[model samples]
Target: MIFPTQYSMLSTEALKSYLEEAYGLNNLGCKLLIHNVSDTYLLAGVDDKYIFKLYRDSHRKLDEIKAEVELLNILKENGAKISYPVTDLKGGQIQSFNAAEGIRNGVLFSFAEGKPTHDYYDSRLQTIGREMAHIHNITADIELQNPRKVYDVRTTLIQPLEYIKSEFTELPEEYAWLQSTTEKVVEKIRHFDLSKFSYGYCHYDFLPHNFHFDEHDNITFFDFDFAGKGLLANDMMTFYVHFFFQVMLKKQSQEEADKNFQTFISAYRQVRAVSEEELAAIPYLGFAFWVFFLEFYQLHFEDWSNTFYNLRFKKERMGWIRNWVEWYCRF
Candidate 1:
C-alpha cells in the first residue's frame, strides 16, 4: 500500500524506543518536522537534539542513500559545517523497518541549531557563497564509496515531460507549450563547454530554506537529499531562481531580484572563478531547473485537492514557472 510521502509516522514513544534501543539516545520528544520528499522528525534528547530522517523507499535507492551519508562525512572532514549521519547500535548508518508503504530506511543526524530563512543581508549572502564554494573545492577530489544519480537532461527534462504526458490525459492548454519550451531548453544546453564549468556534487536544493545561520552570522546547510553530481553553475542558478520566485511571490520588482542575484554571484566569483562561457549557460540551466523542480513535485504528490494543491493553486504555480522561465530565458 502507498503511504503519504512514501513513509510512515513514528510515535514519540516509538521514536524514543528506536533511539534508545538502536542509536542509544534519549529521545525526550519526537516531533514530525516536515514532509516534503521525506518524513523528517525532530528527535529531542536530554541536553541535546537530533533529526531523524526516514527515507521514502521509492524516493532513493540504497546506494544513493549510502552515498549521501558518505558525502556528508567527507564534507565534515573537509571543514564544512554539515549535519552528519549517526550510526545505529549495530554500527550501521541505515535502519530499515517495515511500514505500510513497504520497507523504508531511516537515519539519525545531529541537530544543526538556528533557523532557515528566505531573506538575508548582503554579508550573509556573501558568507553563503564562500561556504558553498568551499564545499565544491573540498569535495572535488574525494570519491564516493557508493554511486549516486547524476543530474542531467534525461533525469531532469525529457523524463519529466514523458511522466507528465503519461499521467494526465487531459491537461491545461499551456501544458503543451511547457513541454515544447522544456525541449527547446534541453536542445540549447545539450552542448556546453565543460572545460570552463565546474562539475561536482551539488546541494541541488541550495536555497535559503535548506540553510540556517547562528548569531555569529555563521551558516549551516542541511537537507542534502537532492545532492548529486551536477554542474556547479546549476546550483548557482537554482539559488537565483528560488530568490526570483520569492520576488514574484512577494510582488517585488525584478530590480530587487537582480540586486540579490548580482550580490550572490559576485561573492561566489570570489570563491570560485566562473568564466563567461559557463555563466552564459546559466539562464538555460535555470530554465531546465524550473522544469525539474516542477516535475519533482508533480510526480511525487499525485493529489492536488489540498488548498496548496488545488486546481487554481496548481495553475498559479505553473504561472510562476512560466513567468520565471521566461524572465531568465529573455536574457
Candidate 2:
C-alpha cells in the first residue's frame, strides 16, 4: 500500500483475463495474495491451479523477469528442487500489458503447496541451507540468456541510501545518524576479500517465506523475484541476518540462535563447501543488509502517503531496527 499512485493490486477480472489470454484458461478463480514487491493472485479452474504475479512499480524489466523464469527452468532441469513457471498458450512464459503506470509484466507459476515456516527450528534451517547449496552448485555454471542484477555492496547498501536521500530532501537527525552509521558499516563490508569467495547466482532474498515444504518434507523454492548474480555466501548471510534478528525480536535465547546457525551452516557444508573466511564475514554482510532493509522501509513507507507510516505500524519496527543496530555495532 506504499505506492498506490504507482502501483495497484490486479483486479479479479483483469487477472482472469491475463490467465486466459496468456495460458488460454477460462473460468479461473482469482484471489489476491499479499501485495508487496509484487501483486500476486492465486488462480484456480477445473484442473488448473496457478499463482499469477504482477510486478509492481515496474521495478523489474521484462528481460529480468524472463531471466527468473529461465533460471527456474534451469534449476528444475538440473534436478534442483523448485516450483517451475508454467508456459502460456503461445509457449511464452511471461505476459506483458499496458497498465496505468506503464508496461507491467506478469507470470503464471505452478502453485507451491505447503505453508511458510513461521516457527523456527534447526531441522527446517538445515533443509533451507542444503537446498540453497544445491541451487548455487548448478546456478554457478549455467550461463543465463537474459541479464539479471548483481547483488553487491553498491546495490545492497549504497543504492538504498541514495534512494532515501531522493525521498527525504532534508534528512531527519535519526536519518542522518543512520547515514553515518551506514558508511561505517559499508567500510566494514569493504574489508571482506570477495575475490576468493563463492560467486554466481545468489537468491538475493532467500528469506524463509520464498520457499515451502511439501508433505514429504521436501522444500520447493519459489519466488525468484530478487534472483541475481552475486557471491553465494551473501545469500547465506542474508538469511543469517534476518533469522538472527527475528529470533532476537521474539526474546529468544542465544542458544536457539546458535543452534539454528550451526545446523544451517553445517548442513549447507554437507552439500557445498563454505570457507572459514566466508563464515567470518557473514556478520558484517548481515549488518550491511540489515541497514539496507531499515533504509528500505524508511524510504518507501515513512511518508504520510504511505500506510506503513502509521505510528502504530512503524513504532515497533523502529524499535527493533534500533536495537538490532546497537547490538550489531556493539559486537
Top candidate by TM-score: 1
| Tens digit of per-residue lDDT, candidate 2, span 68-127 | 999999998898888788888778888776676667898888888776775657777788
For each candidate in turn, give its C-alpha RMSD to the true structure in angstroms: 2.9, 3.8
In model 2, the number of clashes is 0
Per residue, candidate 1 scores C-alpha lDDT tens digits across 275-300 of: 77777787887777766766676666
Best-matching candidate per lDDT: 1
* Model 1 worst lDDT window (10 residues): 302-311
Runs in model 2 lying further than 4 Å from the true structure = 1-5, 24-27, 120-122, 166-173, 298-305, 310-318, 328-331
Taking all chains together, each candidate's TM-score versus the true structure is: 0.89, 0.86
Global lDDT of each candidate: 0.76, 0.75
